[model samples]
Target: MLDLAWRPRAHLDRESIAIHLGLERKAPQAALDAMRRIDDAIERVRTFPDSGGRVRLDALRRTEYRTVLANPYTVYYRFDEKTLTVYRILHQCQNIDTYALVDLPR
Candidate 1:
């Protein structure tokens, strides 16, 4: 399995999602479940790096982005021989355009 690396934005995204679910929506258990699901998706990615569906970005066609769903959220990442780097964790409702993934490493 490749080593895992999380971008700072990805961490922030996760925290934001948890906060929104737990504090804003008053759904602590749902937040916890979402976190668990996200973790499970990450583990799946670690074990099978190519399991995620490819994401197409017009601006960066040369760079491949992949995604794994965690119910209402999605985990976006890229992987190489030695590492799998998670770039973002976003809500399913969000518009996932190039701008939303601007923080991804080139």
Candidate 2:
């Protein structure tokens, strides 16, 4: 069987989710639903990053050390032969550049 890995960025992504959940004015059900979608999306990538290089999640794209879904947030990572190293997570709304996320350790 193939191995699965998550870049450290996934941790930050989870933290970001926590913050979103903490928002006081949002509907609980809708927040939970979105969280579930985000969680499911990441897990889906773990199970199948590509079907021979075609993405399991068609909505994401690879950047230098990061992967961006349709805005809102991004996932940074590095892929080795058998493992993926997550670097950091950020909200696209931050108005920052890639270097801002470089502070994350491998």
Candidate 3:
């Protein structure tokens, strides 16, 4: 099985979604559904690394990130041979070009 590692930003993204949808919007069920979708997408990526669209960042020299969509959310991840690192989870409205990849430990 491929290893899964999550960056801090990804965790924050999930938390933000839960708060915005469940607490702020008062839609617990929808929040749950969204989380489930994100989880499922992550599973798919872990099982099949190439499942997402490959995103090549000019700034990152050695790593290539892939993007997977879970409806309104976009999951950014990178596979470094043995481990899959989930870099960020962003809402669809966010500017994708602003993301800067940093070296993550395996």
Candidate 4:
């Protein structure tokens, strides 16, 4: 089993989602669901990113930050060996870097 732990970056994701919720009614369900799928995807990705099963972020330099989109929303997750961290959750148009936090050994 994967040992998952979310860092401060995850909170940024929550805040991003909140912003969307405030702007519209019915909440960001599609985004929320995408995040959930991402959580599940992390396990497999943790095992392998080149599995052709998940979308990998190629613009972030040498980072593991990647997102899976559900319509206008994007679910962001980070994988660290045994831990698959559910970091950021946001819409496709959201400024992804604004929520970006580099990883350091904890």
Quantify all predictions' global Cα lDDT against the true fold.
Answer: 0.89, 0.51, 0.83, 0.57
Candidate 2's C-alpha lDDT? Answer: 0.51
Query: lDDT by residue for model 4 over 1-106, one digit each (tens)?
Result: 5566666656666555655554454567755665566555555655664342243445664665666554455656666556666665565676766326554345
Q: What's the residue-level lDDT of 65 in candidate 2?
A: 48
Model 3, 27-95: lDDT tens per residue? 999999999999899889888998898765555435577999998898999886788888888888986
Listed in order, each prediction's TM-score against the native is 0.90, 0.54, 0.84, 0.52
Error of 2 at 53 (Å): 11
* Root mean square deviation (Cα) for candidate 3: 2.9
Tell me the spans in candidate 1 whose CA falls farther than 4 Å from its real position. Answer: 104-106
Q: Give the TM-score of candidate 4.
A: 0.52
lDDT of 1 by residue, 1-106 (tens): 8899998889899999899999999999999999999999999999998999888666656678899999988999999999999999988898787776666453
Better of 1 and 2 by TM-score: 1
Clashes of 4: 1
Alpha-carbon RMSD to native, per candidate: 2.3, 5.9, 2.9, 4.7
* Candidate 4 segments whose C-alpha is farther than 4 A from its true place: 15-59, 102-106
lDDT sort, best first: 1, 3, 4, 2
Error of 4 at 8 (Å): 2.9
